[model samples]
Target: MENSPSVKSVAYPYGLMLAIYSILVLVLIYLMNIDQENWVIGTVNSLVTIVLYILALRTFKKKNGGFMKLKEALKVGLAIAAISGIISAVYAYIHYSFVYPEFLDMMYEKSYLDITERNMPQAQTDQALELSKMTLSPLFFATTTLILNLFFGFLISLIVGLIMKRENPAYQ
Candidate 1:
């Protein structure tokens, strides 16, 4: 029954899920372009990040394979997150770097001023800019994006694995 549904089919849904996530991220960015404050980009992205892991686990289950081992499930979930996150990060980097370079400057200036205005230490403002730069950098942003994805993915996979896993019970 090699042709029958198996964990092998996980590839299809996993790919589709990631594709959808990517598209959604793009739409979120577009919305941000319209109104920066209205941008819940990080939140939406983080939530979808979790969705990707859960979808991967669900697909794995649908494949009729042996119950997912915790380790294997974790690996699969993290992998999906890493790939999806990197893609989204890259897209954002390009959009900001080329399409909207001013956005970065705006964010930087706003934070710098806000911190100073609030009587916060200069170091805090500098620190915020430093962190933001790392995230805004095309290269570093992509790398951190992958790391963030893997980090969250691992946690999600662990939790989803606990819920989704099913071992065949003996009842004969």
Candidate 2:
């Protein structure tokens, strides 16, 4: 246990990676709302995120060890993802609950109006509103957020492990 690296050593990589992802998400949200036809922004953002995550993974490996075992890498990556998810989700909750309590209402009203204007089915609008309300629940939001981020982490770990694993040659 004494020889095992403490969790503190992993914090920096986890936090820095999340910060980068968050910035990308904010930009994506802004672009998406600004121009529906400019979905290229999202594609570019996702590619850059993958590249950044890979870079961060390489950096973490270099700093932590030349090679990281699969389980260890997965653990560190998931830990980071979980922390970031919780932080981001909490911020979202606060933002919606206090900073902009009317956002949900506004969204519901706009969606309902849009549905009517388009002569779309009323059930679609009602379903969207219900889903929005469910998202307002802290527990559900946090769990889903964590699961989503952890899924990304798992993918990053799979790639990083392929690049970073260095099991000793058994014959040696």
TM-score of each: 0.69, 0.65
Task: Estimate candidate 1's alpha-carbon lDDT, on a 0 to 1 scale.
Answer: 0.65
For each candidate, the alpha-carbon lDDT, in order, equals: 0.65, 0.61
Worst 10 residues of 1 by lDDT: 1-10
Q: Which residue pairs show collisions in model 1?
A: 6-63, 7-63
Ten residues in sequence with the least summed lDDT for candidate 2: 1-10
Best by the lDDT measure: 1
RMSD from true fold, candidate 2: 4.6
Instruction: Report the lDDT of model 2 for residue 152.
Output: 81
TM-score of predicted structure 2: 0.65
What ranges in model 2 sit over 4 Å off?
Answer: 1-4, 20-41, 110-132, 136-143, 169-172
- Candidate 1: how many backbone clashes? 2
- TM-score, cand. 1 vs. native: 0.69
